[model samples]
Target: MPADQELDQELDQELDQELDQELDQELDQDPTGGYRPLVVVLLSPLAFALVFASWTIFAVLGVELKALLGFGEAHFAVLLAMPMAIGGLAALPMAALAQRIGGRRVMIACLLLICPFLWGLSHASDYHHLLLAGAGLGLGAGSLAAGLVYVSGLCPRRHAGLALGLYGAGMVGAGLSYLLLPLISQAYGWRTAPLLYLLPVLLVAALLWLFAEDREAEPDVPDPLQESPPRSPPAALLRRLACWRLWRLALVYSFFYGTFVALALWLPAYLSAQYRLPLREAALAALPFTLAVGVGQVVGGALADARDFRALRWWVSAFVLVCLFLLSYPPFVMQVQGVHGVIALHYDAPLWGFLLLLSLMGAAMGVGKGSLMRLIHRDHRDEMALVGGLALTLGGLFAALLPLVFAVGNEWVGIRTAGFMFLYASLIACMLVMVWDHASDRGARA
Candidate 1:
């Protein structure tokens, strides 16, 4: 039978099985709760957090790495971009690899493999060793995208929003790094900072492996709606890339991911340099921004579930506007007034402004993040591989540029240029989203 017919048959079988399960549960005298949804949701985050904590080691330790290794600003920028660059390259294969192994199994393997590299990195005597270790860390961390898919699959459709939101909260590891890693570095020095994370890493992995069940696989299952894999489709591939609706959704994801990652890697360094705060103090300032981002993910996930795509567009647009305003506020404040204006505002004005910007941006991006995934599901359900892969690839590519942009901006335009870049990016993103919203409406009406 053709692939589409096979798919239809599979769906029928799946539906039948689900019905049988439901009926069996109804007949049972006691419907003992197996794994509570709350347990699954909470465990997923804790597992995810361990991975993310390792994912952000370099970002948290950026300043220390620069000092210890005597790296130039440009080299530091390269170090910053490396993980995301590798993650983009690794995502597709990791997704496929997850299918071959299993997401939960692969995720556990990655955690085990990735955590040791953090220790190696802490001990790196030279740049070459650190770069190689970073590559290992990068490849290992790509398992996370696969883990997201796993989490999405585990939940029923009705609860996907809350489930994913819970998963995203694991990003609090980024915040946790800023809050804790710096203190570790201060108390124990940079050499031992990464090692300290080992305790949590081991604990979380052991817990997850014990609690998380493997997702069942059905190899002979048919997907009736799926077209047969094309032997030659060069032109089709090109057209798919150019699909207008797909591009619009990709744009949102790129910004949402790019914003989240850029900060995850750069915020600690930014705080330390701009404010001349000690590593520990800087971490505290950066903590709220990261935590706010985690909060934003939950908020965004909730909103995406409740609202229409049009409402989501407006919400995202408003979010970008807020980010832009927050980014530009300090400069705007300075321009309208003078040096005395700075004094009146006090020395901490820029820091406060940055925190505010980060809070708004993080939450906005979180909401946009889930909505982006939903948009892909809605628009290109059949062609998810091409669309999701390209969106993630592009997001990673853009993310690759951010550290360099910050480094160069600091070199040429002054340290404040980092804020200006955020401001500019936010402005353009807002404009494009508004335009896309209009385009979508026109297309729908037509």
Candidate 2:
């Protein structure tokens, strides 16, 4: 061979050797490899459940606070949405830090940081103090960004959907809060409700520290970035954002996950006001929505793992669209002219009917949530943390904004169901985007 060709061949061999070493370093080498990954998968959701419960406790507590502070609906909306707004904006920076330092470390630090805030919330004496404490509680939302990265690294690509889906089920914590926080408040006092969250937060932190392995240590595969030159965190984030698909998915997520967060915060107040139900009964009625979301995520994740994602997305979207349409219809009275006499018709959804529709909507949103995460993994495996954070931030932004929107709509329209009309419109926009994207893809292929 020529001397130039020989040198090129030698360099290629050396590069291959380096790649092998890096892969070996990154992947787990345990004799019971599958067992350890399974354990991580099972335990991650429990920790996430704790984090999610703490993060969203404001929803349950806001009712009592509104009464205690004598705030109007608008003020109460802002108070309830404070954490999600802060958390959404903070997601990018936290995800960047997690990428640099390691998600496990980031997750632990977030859990610890939020503990003092939870303690403070329990002692908050005034509206300002509660706002401060709520802002602090927003720190717990960082755990989701870190947990997504950490769990993604542990599970194999084939099972990524299932693993993330199970982790997503931790959102059932929101429902649990509706059930437990009210009982706790009635038994101990509203002030004692936040104090209870400290136990699970600390316990989950300990569990993660003791059992969870760092991403580098858990996975045996080489980092995809090993071959590429390193970029600054900001640059890396910007690069990910440049992808139009990320933004598209983020918009879709804002509709689904955003609506979920908005409802989680708004439902108790909604039920009590619209249906004239007691506080406890309203919270109980909202429980099914949260439960359905959790169950739907688990089922969706498993199906995504076993089936085609495109089909799953279409089915979930269609189901949710129908639910939103039904939910948007406000109670009305109509008169019909007949040959014999005028007939008057009144239509109003019973509390049970409302709960049933909301439960179904929540389930569809949950499935879409899992599928969205799976799509992120499929398209941006290397940038999961950054992309996940971006997507979540957008969703959180919508979550934060929608409650205020709901409040404004209710104030202006004097209809309790005004929020559902907004949701219905938002879903219509999402469907339009989906259709355009689908057509664009087909045209390009043709």
Per-residue lDDT over 1-446 for candidate 2, one digit per residue giving the tens place of the 0 to 100 score: 44654575466446545654654454546554545566678766876677677756766766677888787888878877888888888787787677777878888898899899888988888888878887887777788778877788777666778889998888888877888988999999988888888888788788778877675433446578798777886787677688777776666766777788789878888888889977788888898999999888877777776644655667788888788788877789999998999999999999889898899889888988888787777666677777788887888888888888879878978877888888888888888998898778667656
**Candidates' C-alpha lDDT:** 0.67, 0.79
* RMSD after Cα superposition, model 2: 7.2
Could you give candidate 1's per-residue lDDT for residues 262-358 as a string of tens digits?
A: 6677777777887788766777777777777777778766655554343575666676666665564333322245666633332335677677777
TM-score of 1: 0.80
TM-score per model over all chains: 0.80, 0.88
Query: For model 1, what is the alpha-carbon lDDT of residue 240?
Result: 63
RMSD of each: 6.6, 7.2
Residue 364, model 1: lDDT of 71
Q: Clashing pairs in model 2?
A: 26-219, 27-219, 27-220, 28-220
| Residue-level error in angstroms, candidate 2, position 14 | 27
TM-score of 2: 0.88
